[model samples]
Target: MTRSELVTALAQRFPQLQTNDTGLSVNVILERMAEALTHGDRIEKRGFGSFKINFRLPRTGRNPKTGQCVQVPAKAVPHFKPGKELRDRVG
Candidate 1:
């Protein structure tokens, strides 16, 4: 579900929590996760998954538009691996 949908679900699940508070909490959690990734830190939620960064080496690539050769710079990308529990549940 989308972010807003998540907030709504949380609010409903925890009747004691206000919708605004739920939304803020969700935003904070997501922001922190993003911050951790940017700092090259790994985040893990046991039954959910893990988030980490993967580095890509610089290489030559072709532009799909014209098939022109281009130099691609090295970059760090966020990657997620599902936990065994989550994998089994999804499967």
Candidate 2:
């Protein structure tokens, strides 16, 4: 589900929590996660998954349309590794 959908679900699930409060709570959690990733930190949630960054070294890449060679810059990308419980549940 989308972010708004998640907030709505949380609000519905917890009747004591107002919709606004639920929305803020969700936003805070997501913002913290993003902030941690931005700082090159890893977040591991047991029974769920681990979030980390993978670095890609500079390399040559080709343009699909013209097949032109291009230099690709180094970059860090967010990566996720599912925990065993999550993997088993999905499977």
Candidate 3:
């Protein structure tokens, strides 16, 4: 679900917390995740999943439209690996 939906769900689940507080909590969690990712750190939540950064090397790719060669720059991408518990639950 989207962030708003998540916030709503959290607010509903925790009746003592205000809607704004729930939103802030969600934002803080996401901000922390972003900070960790920015520093090339991995996050592993038990029974959930792990998030890590993967590097992509520079490569030459062809443009589908023009069929011309293009140089693709290297980049770091976020990767997620589901924990066994999560996989088992889904399965």
Candidate 4:
């Protein structure tokens, strides 16, 4: 779900929290997760999934429009692995 949808769901599930508070909480959580990932730290939620960074080595790629070969620079990218419980539940 989108951020707004998640905030709404949390607000609905917890009547004690205000919508704005829930929104702020979600924002804080997402910001912290991003910060952790930026620092090359792994994030794992049991029965849910894990997130980590993966490196892609530099490679040659072709431009789709011009069909021209280009050098692609290496970089780090985020990756997610679903937990067994999550995979089984989804299946």
Assess every candidate by TM-score: 0.96, 0.97, 0.96, 0.96
The C-alpha stretches of model 3 lying farther than 4 A from their native spots are none
Candidate 1 ranges with C-alpha deviation above 4 Å: none
Q: What is the Å distance of residue 69 in model 4 from its true position? A: 1.0
| Per-residue alpha-carbon lDDT of candidate 1 for residues 1-91, written as tens digits (9 for 90 to 100) | 9999999999999999999999999999999999999999999999999999999999999999999999999999999999999999999
Question: What range of 10 consecutive residues in model 4 has the weakest lDDT sum?
Answer: 29-38
The lDDT per prediction is 0.98, 0.98, 0.98, 0.98
Q: After aligning candidate 1 to the native by TM-score, how far in Å is the CA of 27 from where it should be?
A: 0.4
Which 10 successive residues of model 2 have the least lDDT summed?
Answer: 3-12
Tens-digit per-residue lDDT, 1-91, candidate 4: 8999999999999999999999999999999999999999999999999999999999999999999999999999999999999999999
* Model 3 C-alpha lDDT per residue in residues 38-86, reported as the tens digit of each score: 9999999999999999999999999999999999999999999999999
Error of 1 at 38 (Å): 0.7
